[model samples]
Target chain A: MDIFSFVNFFLLPGVVQGSIYALGAIGITLIYAIMRYGHFAHGDLATFGAFTALFVAGLLGLSPYAALPVAVVVAALLAIAIDWLFYAHLRRMPKIITTIASFGVALMLRSVVQIIWGVDTTSYTRGISRPENWFGIRVKPHELVTLLVVIGLVIALHLFLTRNKWGKAMRAMSDNPDLALLSGIDNNKVIAMTWVIAGGLCAASGFFLGLNTELRSLMGWNILLPTFAAAILGGVGRIEGAIVGGLVVGVTEELSVLVIPSEYKMLSSFAILLVVLLLRPTGLFRGKIL
Target chain B: MDWLSFTIYPVYLMIFMCIYGCLAIGLNIQWGYAGLFNAGLAGFFAVGAYTSAILTTSEAAGRLGGFDLPFPFGLAGAMIVSGLIAWPVGKICLRFRSDYLAIVTIGVAEAIRLVAKTEDWLTNSARGITGVPRPLGDLPYAQAQLAYLAIVGLILIVVYLLIERQAHAPWGRMMRAIRDNERAAVAMGKNVPVRRLEAFMLGSALMGLAGGLYVHLARTITPDAIDPMLVTFLVWIMVILGGSGNNRGVLLGAVIVWIIWSASEIVTDQLPAEFALKAKYGRMFLIGLLLQIVLRFRPEGLLPEKLRRAPLSEGALSPTGHGARIQAPHKEI
Candidate 1:
């Protein structure tokens, strides 16, 4: 392939992959902003959402596209339930408590999946290969589907965040929980809503990711680092930053095949993360802080 | 392979848990007492295991051209390797906020595991190093295991007592100050970085020691054998459940958790095939549920790290233990 084709090929996958990663990273950044401490369980949460979508689609005999909307709904509900179960009472606890609790929640979720589905990895859609031919690239139908969904979600999210009352409320709470609460934001209601939005986005990201590749109960946990790196690199607590950082990391990792072995794909992400963390503590584009 | 045979193994495993208890207690000193998280405990453990594997079982001088060094020297080398790694990680990672630091440490852990897994030059590829003989393996089987257990148990006891004593000493006080409030300690002229580094190195070295003990029992080592989730998370649970800073509670925590872990693996094999899967997950679910509930109900932990108090007459505990009150006010970074 010529340089144009190679770069385009690279950018296409990078952008598509980055968008899903960005979606997941946004949830992490938002959680970090309000909850404090890393949410180790997030990758699994995405996996759970995707697995839920896979199950619902199989049960209802719906196509991948049709199953996606229902999956989003289920994921939102699940997020709300998880938050209520684990994070609701944790508001009063110290920071580390929530971090540890998230780990617990993560482990429990993965174990439930393992017990129910068996350790063997499963996928949302089966057999017939996703045909290549989108934008002169060898991208598949599922890849295109993932890309379109991500772009739509990102745009919708940006508008909701900028123009909506609840968006401002969410931003305020992230900025300063105490100030937001004092300014008449219902901490409980806002937090529940945060979970809903994050949950929806997480489901969409998970489904799209599953579309691109096969889904395993553990896939989400595996890719969590790049997602977090993107979020942190983009500047924690900023949705745009997550999007940008995700693309950067995805591209860097995929492109690293030039020098490093393919099996060491994760190392590139780790390298980006370590370099980002060491050089820029608050991220390259740190957003407004309290 | 008779599944029932594993039942006889728990008593021996319980003794192993005691070794883990010692490591967790050391971790509690760093994370619980000093608020410095080391997610790379598995890496340190692997380092120790590989150290001994290369030393004790060198019939095949493969990669790194095996020295076949004595076991004692191998253990020392493991401690030194861990301490050396800890110093640099502690320096770079310690500067970030706790959240950032934790994530980075996790990344570092995976990196270390990956290196061992992929680089045959270091750990002899995925085939792993084998034929490791325990210390006194030439003795009778039961007697040798018991001897190994006894010798390791003694080391754990000494390490435990030392940690307990040091936790009350002046240096321990400085660590607590940094944990509770970094700026205040810095203002009081505590070499904050050095002190944190010291705590990290000590904790990591102990973790390496636990790894060494583990290899001696199993008599073989594989890079893939290290489970970051099972090994590191269990340690985190142990320290958190025991109360981050309390040595006594950590031992209890390890014993309780590991007993449950081993018992689950042993007992599940006897179950009817239908219920086997659930039995396997039952253990994982319990740990996760326990961690969440404990954090919610007792945020300080099962036994919160209680500060060693002085007379209230002297105002809040301060530098110089005598009447010197020094609270360094902060200038934000």
Candidate 2:
């Protein structure tokens, strides 16, 4: 294939896909850092968020982009509510119990989505838009929008984490929960804040994925393994690491079709995950081992 | 319903119950005794099912079968192959915490499912492998089912007795010690990793056995049969609800949960077609909710593990010791 075709078909799509995985991985890494458990419901929660955005867009007769904020807010609240109802009491027990509970929550969320939307694939728009040629490469409008939004979200999150007091509190909690508690950081407030940020980002990721591809009940679940691969690759608790990890996983998956059967594209991410776990359990950014 | 038909359904349910009983007990060994969170139970189960199907089936043009082996050999091959797969997985993942094991195992299971779906030469791809022989399968429907049930029941009983013996043995006590306190077990000179690997492989072998039993009963094998929800999560709930560490408790859990699961389908079928389709997901929602309620209210399950207590010296009863005894095992994962 020509370089232009490679750039358009492989590189651009990989970057876009990577950006989406980065969004999801950020949420996962943050949850792992703060709560210290793998949030199995995360992918399904993203599915719920994407569907929520679709619902809002249809109900309000607005553009999907305009409905994004509503979805983010709703998903954030849903995250907090789930934490309260299902996970709050389990806080004192073993973290594995919470993980198992989250698996149940995953099933619940997916079922709820299926009950509401049925199983057919749906899209925000009816017709496809051709990618505009820029220099020697081609990029679609939505793909550009996805990249820009991801950059904006990451920069804003960086500022929030570095500058804001509550954000510092979250960092403190993640760094050392007992110490943070001793320092008079309201543990519950920091946790709720983490959920808000994680949930909102999860929605944005899901929305972008749905915008680029078609939305289905299984879409989030399908991407979950790759998103996780990205999170662990970047290191479990590192934001910047997650971004780089996402991009790497995404580009590799897109490129792997050249060598392996397209049917086995997902295996690329799984391989990356296993390799990373074997070589560097702490991830690329030296995140916590746990 | 005719008496024969009525009798057959219950027998069929019982047979399935036995299969699930095998799975639950296997999971109990890993999760209850060793505290290893194996989210890829379906992978092992699928491996066993596919191995047995391939071994026993007659010649097929495209796939790797034609062994035409007997039922016993198929079952044995299933267990051996499944255990072999678990070896590397346990070796790598057992060093990590329970959550990491959970995610990694989930990945492995998904990978296995993908392979089963895509590899045509091995699994016959989406069409799946069919025409596998069943023991006494040539008999009339009811008689065949009863015979299969008797065979499975005998197997289940044998498995139960063997595992019960192991559970009461010193091996079981060491496993509990490691689960309850890893450092203590290590300090006491126990080979934690090796012991864990043993439990993992043994449990996986039984899961393979369950898969073999399922394939023989269905007389076919399909990738869809390895559903994460049906094979993996259902068994998880069974083990948890039945009381993880206790073998009999998990069997009870299997019987109860399987009845509810199968019966719920009948109830849902009574609804309008559109509503019936949705009710399937609704039932899943209820099952998920049931888990949360159980975890919240009775994390110890209906039948809690009974710890063996040492006899107290005469007039040497200590209230603090008694209180510690009550609180000790409750901390288990």
Candidate 3:
């Protein structure tokens, strides 16, 4: 097998997974900036979105694609609700305390999903179809869509963060909460907007993931660690960090199977996180300007 | 009394409450008092449990496996070995700030869990060593649990009291100083890193002791037996809810939270099969909701450690001092 061709088999899958990961990482990084702790629940939130999409698909009798937008909206609203009730109150607590609370929130949300959806894995009927040949390398429809979605979302998020006033306010709050408050930004509204945007994005990514692979309640728990690893690797509080870090993780993990057993793919991502932390805890690409 | 004869489970549950309670107190020392975040507590606890189970079980060591060391020695060995493993981790971990340490510690924990699942030579892999001869085989499983509970309970009480003493001592004061503001404490000539290491190591050692006891009581060890995030997060909830710097508060938080979290599981067991299974998760969601609410409402904890206001006499400032380091005026939740 050609090294590049063989690499494609793995690399193509990585991009799809990486895109899904990037979506989740963006939400995670956003949460870290606004909330100031790793949102352990992001994975579950993604799972929740996928589950919600599945629920909508079955209930409305819509195809997965048709129901996708609805699912995303519902999931985004649920994210808002969870934040409104749980996370919003934790702003004053110590960062670690809030983080621990967030873990509790994640656990609770996952448990709720387990209770509501049951543990059975569900997926779209059509799922991602066959791979299309691209330059002697084959990629699937969902994979292609995944790449497209990632690009679109990143561009969309970049526009939101840089161009939009709400995005600027969110960025300002993250940069200096006290200053933002003193400057007369409504912290609560900014916080809610942050939740709304992040939640919406999380839903979209989650739906894409469900499209790519099957959805299970444990899926959220499984990726929770990696989502965190990506966020940490990407400097925990930067969107660009999220994008770059996620791709690096995606490719590194895909490349890892060349040497290590595929069962340990996640370990590769974790290994990257450890090395990053030890060598440059601040992250590889560090600059104040996003 | 006759009508409530199934009261044994409550007793059993109470014992469980104690085991987790001990673990929570160990957490309190590290996270609450010292500001260390240990996400892999479940891993270390599992290590202790497997160590004790293997040392005592005939399946593990065979006839030669019978060091036949008394339970106390077995317990000591369990603690020693687990702490020995934790020592290097703590050393490496203590070199960093809280967040980085937390990320690495969680990874360490995840790695250990997988190792426990895959390490057939040590953990018997998934087949898990069965037929673990109970220390008191004559007693029924239920009765044995109570016995273990009593023993562990006494040990927990002792540990609590000891920590209580330490919390008031000058040494505890120094730890509090370090946790409240690391840079300030360092400016005062405290060895911040060393102080953090001591707290982290001591906490891990106690956690190991709890693990040894947990395995002995359960009489078996499995990879699934320990969930690292649950262990760490649950302890954090307990400590934070009880007031981070307060030993007494942790005890209360641990028992209350354990009972509440499990009560839902017990209730779920009675639920109409499908929904009941789901109820267990309901409890999890509620906990997350609760932690957020609890921290928001009472960041000081349900029974937060009171600010140390009692005067610290100069001569009384030793490790064995009566003041419990918490007596310093420094405030923390």
Candidate 4:
């Protein structure tokens, strides 16, 4: 294949896919850092958010992008409600219990989605758009939008974490929960805030994924391993690391077709996860071991 | 339904209950005794199911088979292969926190599913392997089922007795010590990693045996049979609800959960066609909700682990130390 075709088929799609994985990984890493438990329901929550946006777009007769913020807000609220309903009581128990509980929540969320949406693959728009050629490179409009949105969200998150007081409190809590509480950080509030950010980002990721590819109930679940792979690869808890990890995993998955069967693309991420967990559980950015 | 047919339904249910009993007991060994979270029960179950299917099947053109082995050999092959796979997986993942093990096992299960789906030469791809022989399978339908049930029941009883023996043995006590307090276990000169691996492999072997029993009963195996929801999570709820750390409790749990699960399917099938599909998902939602309720209200389960001695007041049944936080030096962003 020519370089242009390779870039079009492999590099461009990889970057767009990476952006989506990055968005989801950020949510996972944040929740891992703050809650100290892997949220198994995260992928399903993203599915819920994506479907919620689809619902809002259809209801309001607006473009999918116009309905994105509504989905984000709704998902954030749902995240908080779920924590209160299913996870809050388990906080005093082992974190593993909370993790198991999250798996239950995952099943519930997926079933809810299946019940509402009827388990059909769907897209935001009816017709596909052709990629515009720019200096020997081809880029689709939605793909460009996805990258822009991811960049904007990351920049906004970076500013918020570095400048905002609540953000600092979240960092403190993640760094040392007991010390953060000793320093008068309201633990519950910080946790709630963490959910808001994670949930919103999760929605954005799901929305973009739906926009780019068709949405199915299993879409979120299928991508879950790769997203987790990205989180751990970036060294769990490091925002920049998650982004880089997401890009690496995405690109690797896209490029793997050249060497292995396309049916086995998902294996690349699983392999990365195993290798990373075995060699450097601290991740690329030297995140917490847990 | 006719009286004989009706009687067969309960027998069929009992047979499945025995299969799940094996699965639940296996999980109890890992999660209850060793505190090793293996979320990939379906993978091991699949490994066993396919191995037995291939072993006992008369012949096949595309896939690996034609061993035409007996039922006993198939079951044994299943256990041996499943245990071999678990050895490497346990060696690598047992060092991490239970949650990481959960995710990794989930990955392993998915990977296994992928392999089963795509590897046509090995698993016959999506069409799946068929026509595996069953022991005493040539008898009349009712007689065949009864004989199979007897065989499975005997196996379950034997497994229960053996595991119960192990649970009371010194090996079991060492496992509990490691689970309840890893540091203390290590300080006491126990080989924590090796012991954990032992429990993991043993439990996996049991799951494989259950898979073998299931494949023989069905006379066929399919990639779709290895559902994470049905095979993995259901067994988890069974073990948790029955009471981890107690073999008899998990067996009770298996029976109760399997009855509820199968009975709920029957009830949902009675709904109008339009609602029946939705009710299936709704039932899953309820099962998921049931887990939350159990975890919230009765973490110790229906029959709490009966202590031979006074239990540790703090971190009772907790897998890891409550206050043992790993200190990672903070670096400037």
Q: Mind giving the per-residue lDDT tens digits that candidate 4 earns over A1-290? A: 99999999999999999989999999999998998888989899999999999999999999999999999999999999999999999886777888889999989999999999988899999987988989989999999999999999999999999999999999998898899999999999999999999999998988998999989998888888899999999998898999999999999999999999999998899889999988998999998877
Alpha-carbon local distance difference test for all models:
0.76, 0.89, 0.73, 0.88
Q: Score the docking of each candidate (DockQ).
A: 0.43, 0.55, 0.38, 0.55
Error of 4 at A204 (Å): 1.3
Which digits, one per residue and each the tens of the lDDT, describe model 1 over residues B206-254? 8878877788778878877877777888888887776677788778788
Interface RMSD of 1: 5.6
Interface RMSD (C-alpha) of each candidate? Answer: 5.6, 3.5, 5.7, 6.4
Ranking under TM-score, best-scoring first? 2, 4, 1, 3
Poorest stretch of ten by lDDT in candidate 4 chain B? B324-333
lDDT of 2 by residue, B195-275 (tens): 999999999999999999999999898888766855788898888887888898889999999999999998999999989
For lDDT, candidate 3 versus 4, the one ahead is: 4
Q: What share of the true interface contacts does candidate 1 keep?
A: 0.48
Q: Residue-wise lDDT of candidate 3 within B163-265, one digit each (tens)?
A: 8899889878888878766668889899977777777877877887888877776767788866565677677777767777778888888888887878778
TM-score of chain B of 3: 0.86
lDDT tens per residue, model 4, B1-333: 445666688999999999999999998999988887888899999989999999999889999989998889999999999999899888888888877778788888888889999999999999999898888999978878989999999999999999999989999888888876688888999999999999999999999999999999988888897667657889988988888888988999999999999999999999999999999889888888988998887877887676553467555544443222111101112
Best by lDDT: 2
